[model samples]
Target: MSKKETKIYKNVWKPGTEDAAKKFGFIRPEDIIRKNVQKKPTSKIDQILTGWGNYVKSHFVELSPELKAESQKRLEICDPCNMRDRGTCSTGRQGAHVVTGKLMKGCGCRLAAKALSPGSVCPLGKW
Candidate 1:
């Protein structure tokens, strides 16, 4: 994909930002047109269920300043990720009603809270 494709995420991009295109290569059509293809949301109900299970496995894992710091480190990466949307992953693959495989929305978790919790992990391993 091109910088042009970032627009789908509401980012502003110039077609021929000479310096940036030169640096990123993919931004230049001459380099790669099919670059940066959006990935398939691969998390299945089993994964979401697994994520939730981790949440339970780590039960009683209380919050500490360190955990907050750890979660922040993860969220920082998430903020700029392509699949991130409204604090959820685009690959909430099983859909919103995913527990039953009946929706097309983002990952249902409130990322800030969940990422901070020991009970959860990013389905995409981004964090």
Candidate 2:
């Protein structure tokens, strides 16, 4: 009896995925594939509470000029980050600070409020 060999397929992209990705202006077809990569789930309740707390602290409370400056610096770093989608840190996205190469996780917080809050820390450790 001979042992059978199993063929393993790699880089198996789904049908029409590349086309749809192109239609949406994705620069690389691989970017679409990367989005489907599974990541460990972050706590939604924790994210929600943290976001709310930061929002309240940043908005209702007074911040020093130093804190405001710090927020500006953080925003500058976040502006070009791949994990930042719209205004929020995109949860479960991979990659890191584009320049620094540190590993990243999405905290699911609004960047503006999160930066302004004195106690808030970045999921990517940018700040």
Candidate 3:
């Protein structure tokens, strides 16, 4: 066959993996093979709180806390949430952003402000 014709034939008739396995001894890797990478488990609170801010914004009307006691309770829960930072949350997992020269959080809300809002409900039901 001409060089071009031989090349085209070879391309068209390339062996399938299964066929190659039979011809040249192949072994699939074992399914249970372990890798060396170690990773930490995600916080349960953080996972639970995901997407909660958006849900609250749509379903609840923001209100100023009627009782200092109520705000304090909410703040206690938020203070340790995995998604929460100094005052912001990992809403989009980016932590925080500055808008109008003021900082806002990933969840599109700040925990301190949101916790104090009378009508706001905790997405994860912590408060």
Candidate 3 per-residue lDDT over residues 35-109, each given as its tens digit = 123434545444335335433653575534454467678778778776666776556543222223433334546
Tens digits of per-residue lDDT, candidate 1, 1-127, equal 5455655323323454545645644245543444445434445554456545545655666546776677778889778765677887765443233244444544567566566555455555544
Off by over 4 Å in 2: 1-62, 97-103
Instruction: Give each prediction's root-mean-square deviation over alpha carbons.
Output: 15.4, 18.4, 16.4
- In candidate 2, residue 42 scores what lDDT? 48
- Local distance difference test, per candidate? 0.56, 0.67, 0.51
> Superposing every Cα of model 3 onto the true structure, what RMSD results?
16.4
Worst 10 residues of 1 by lDDT: 94-103
Off by over 4 Å in 1: 1-63, 91-106
Ranking by TM-score: 2, 1, 3
Specify the highest-TM-score model's number: 2
- Which residue pairs of candidate 3 clash? 63-118, 91-106, 91-107
Give a tens-digit lDDT track for model 2, residues 1-127: 1122111111222455555435544435465566667544546555556556756776778756787788789999989988899998888697665467877678878888777665667776767
Candidate that beats the other on TM-score, 1 or 2, i.e. the better one: 2
Order the candidates by lDDT, highest first — what do you get? 2, 1, 3
Model 2: lDDT to the true structure? 0.67
